[model samples]
Target chain A: MGTIARNGWASLEDIRDILYLTDARLDAIARDVPIRRWCECFDLRARTIFPRPKKSQAGVVGYDGVAAADVAALLIYLERLGYELEPLPLVERLMDVIRSNPYLTNAQLSVLWYERCRHKCEPLVLYLADAARPKLAETRRLRTTTGYTIEVATSADGTPIWLSASAPKYRKRRVSTPETCLQCGYVWTRGDPDSSAAHRREHKKRLSYLDPQPVVELVAAVAAGENTISVDRTSPRWKHREIYRRALAFKREFGYDFVQWQSDKGDDDPGAAGVLFCNAQNVIVGACAFRLREYQGRSWRALQWIWLAPKYRRSGILTTRWFDLRRQFGDFRVEPPVSEAMQAFLKKMGDESLMGAPLSSTLPER
Target chain B: MGDMDPAPVDVLNDEPHFLSEPEVAQALERMLNEFQRETDRGAVLIAGEMVSAQLAAEIRALAPPELRGKRINELLKYPGFLSSFSARCDVALLAGFIDASAHRSTVVLRRLRNDAAHSTDAFSLAVHRERLMQMCSLGSGVAASVSEFAAKSVLDDVVYRLKQRGMTLENEIGRNPFSSAAEIFEHLSVRPDLMAVLDERMPKMELAIGVWLLLGLIVHQGKRRRAERTTGDIDDAN
Candidate 1:
């Protein structure tokens, strides 16, 4: 007796194991005595199993192995009998159904049998009739609801098949094509009036998010040669919630996974110090955040996140005031995975001492 | 004819610290040696291009057999996917030929190279000193004027590290580099048209820029296939 590999080819003994049939019973069935001599009428040996050499023992052998496809076909044909060993003429009819739709796998056949064929005497005719009934009903419903005419034709065996579905004879409205904004990455349909209006609003909103308008004092300060302002978590100005909000937005725009500030955690450290850069028009075009950390008994100012508006970039706005920043935040160290633009800026500074160790190195270990 | 001449004051008395001929010669020699050690902006840019070209070659060699035949020059030239040095570095990192530090160094070098090439003003270490510092560490006593040398050293170190990493990867994979996701799927008998659709959609999803995600997918698929094989299951679900 051969054992079956899971999901692999099954021999006669394996099939007996699956069906819980005794060797005597399977042999009796195969010999065409039981199950109304169905196996004999259909010639199961000719259709079901093709002989192949055993995989375990090669060379000197007889054709003993069965193919998975042949095993599946046999299983599907036997499944029509259900739990009852008493066989019916339905074996040939199921074989005809399998021959017509050869692509249906054993799994699919099992599903179909369970859904519409199980416990029925004339499963094939009933299954075909049941499958076509819904499609015909759906066609009728579609014609009535959608004002479209659908044609259903029947084959010689009376299985209804769809011919075509056509719309009513009326001019169709053209669909709107989707358009994307190159600057802000906004996408909207072109021909839709409402969508176009929404796109305009979204475009303005996204631009504002990228380049936030500065407060009145900050604007006045920019005009007074005080273009940049630094505020730590402990600073009096930090009491205002607006700066923190803008900082969070800038952090999000900078692609940081978390926008929550360290100060928000209520740490004893000074938390983050933000330096906002206002452009010539007094718009807060850029922001840089730093954490004042004590490492190895020395204060280290680590750069957390830095971002500038797209237009104000490369204008030497940050570079010109770098010394002032260094003076304010002593021993500045940039975080790792530094941006290429920042790398260029660091190079432009021409100060090797400014290239401090990574921010992680400055943090206390857990 | 008598000519009246004024007495010459001895400058040596006033300046006793004036060097002898050999001392002056030695001093001049020292300055000349220091000048030779300093790498100019043009030299740094050229060195960057050279290092990038070599790194590109090493990466190309480590690529799968299908991509190995594609010329590095063609791939790293204008309009190519790996045209920019940054892109090449990213591909090298994704392909596992170089680690993150090496990738960062390459990026720094590329930035320095761009600054050198694009700057209209005269090349000065004053401009790119901090960037060069980011790539390579200098001696504690090293003068600020020798930043160009530091830049050159960083480029050399990057080239050497990349070469070593490529060799290691080749050894680990037994000279057969891991195939890309598309190639693996192709080997698994996935339809070419489906793979083509994936290829077209992947760039739109920005997956092409960061292809390590696809590499991760390939590894996952390989494991799943092995698991299916072990379980003796026919995996038609994919």
Candidate 2:
């Protein structure tokens, strides 16, 4: 076959090998995930014999049900660990190998690639340097000096209240202190007029390459088959209504089907600690806001907000972190990689499919 | 032939002084011979070295063999063994003088010899003729520097004679000397002064330069045809 044809169908064989799984144990895994065209006759091929020195009862060396089970287990494990699978297989493998053995320096991985996979050196090196490490700490610290909260008077009796301030130095201001409207009505400082007007204007500018954020945020809800992503109802600076409206507008444009509320996983609450949120490394460029809740004796986490810098697509780093986290611990209902133009983009980079089933999004038609 | 071998020779059992001329000759012979056995390309190279060494031996026939030995070594190392490349010069000259005339007809023979001396393959017959011509021209320069015998003229004379004796002049025009006076002077003289003078007076270099320009023009001219080829068939004329 020609190069393009060969490459196009290359992943199909791997997926076929994956779908080569059989037995009652993996049935839920097969059923719970979206079934593609390759799942049919998975059992028949799973049992086919090829000539080889007999090693064990398992017919093939690498394709046994145990190996498939190990893959599933790894997927579940990464979920718990809060890692994202890269859309590219080689990239995913590189990250997986690195994470599994962090002591193996990047040089050692590069040398391994040189020795075992000489032709793949460029991609391996590039992904490692550009995609993998950056994904680990893509959080960009937002310039929060301009963003402000407005406080309005809540007291029945008209009382002169400290309504406006620049960044407040420490003061013993009570929560019960008379709050008057500064800009709208919340208990935070307002920006200077010119700065506030400029900030408002900047917010109105539309940025392309910001689509990955909605997708990342909708991962959990998409898995659950839900339509709305949720952020905390009480962020003093930004209102929940605005956040939801923005997310829905993004969905309408980007075709994301679901969004769910995300609560930061705080200590002293085992249940809340399971929800996903932006980590220190993820603070600047990429952040996933998700919520974990119990449903039918199973924990379900819904991602409501995922924003990445416009520059980070195709790097495979952030996506790998997402999948790595899922495979390690979240034990999520798996999904296929993304499709349409995103698939084309990922395919150009030899990335795996990222359009996996959402942990909570609406189900595909049977 | 015995001198060409690398079998250990215990010189300690012999007189303790500088190696004799025959001894140095033997050493060079041994080095060249060993090179022959180790490489498939080596035999041709050894033959070239033998011719060069034999000619040097004849030139210094009356000198003390010891002085000749030291002189030979100096000559061998003149441009460095790798640069003034005696083995390659010998091969190209030998092929020109003794090989099939058709093989010698290729202007790239000198290049083929040089490449064979340093590398592992023979130049194929079907490369771009201009490239071969360039190689031959460059190889001639190296050969002239190494041989130091003013022998490039002799090779040119032989090529001219072949051309005069009703050999094809078309392929040789750009590459061989007889096509033009500048090339003739280049082939026949080893003097740097003479070549510098010719360079001032020559249009052949201009022609060579023009060929490069023409190549660029052809590429631009055929670009549409090439693009059509990429899309599929260029024409149904096939």
* DockQ (model 1, Cα): 0.01
Rate residue B122 of model 2 by lDDT.
47
* Per-residue accuracy of model 1 over B1-238 as CA lDDT, tens digit each: 7887876768766422223334333433443333334445644554455446645655665555566564655776788788777887788768666556556656776777787788887766445546655554222323232344433333343334334433444544344221333433333233342233222222112211111222222233333444555566455543
Q: Per-residue alpha-carbon lDDT of model 2 for A1-366, expressed as tens digits?
A: 122122322222343333344223334454555333212212111222233567665654432221222233222222222223212333333444444764754333442343233222111001222222322322122212322222322223433222221121223333333332433222322444554455455433322123222222222122112222223432311223334333443344456766332322212223221222232221123434444545665555433344444456455645556544454334333233233654564455444332343354332221
Deviating ranges (above 4 Å) for candidate 1: A1-158, A163-179, A187-202, A209-217, A220-228, A234-255, A260-269, A358-366, B1-238
lDDT, candidate 1, A193-276, per-residue tens = 999999999877667636455343342232222323665554333222434545566565567666645443222345666776
Cα lDDT listed for each candidate: 0.49, 0.34
Error of 1 at A128 (Å): 9.8
How big is the positional error of residue B176 in model 1, measured in Å on the Cα after superposition?
69
- In terms of TM-score, how similar is model 1 to the real structure? 0.31
Each model's TM-score?
Answer: 0.31, 0.17
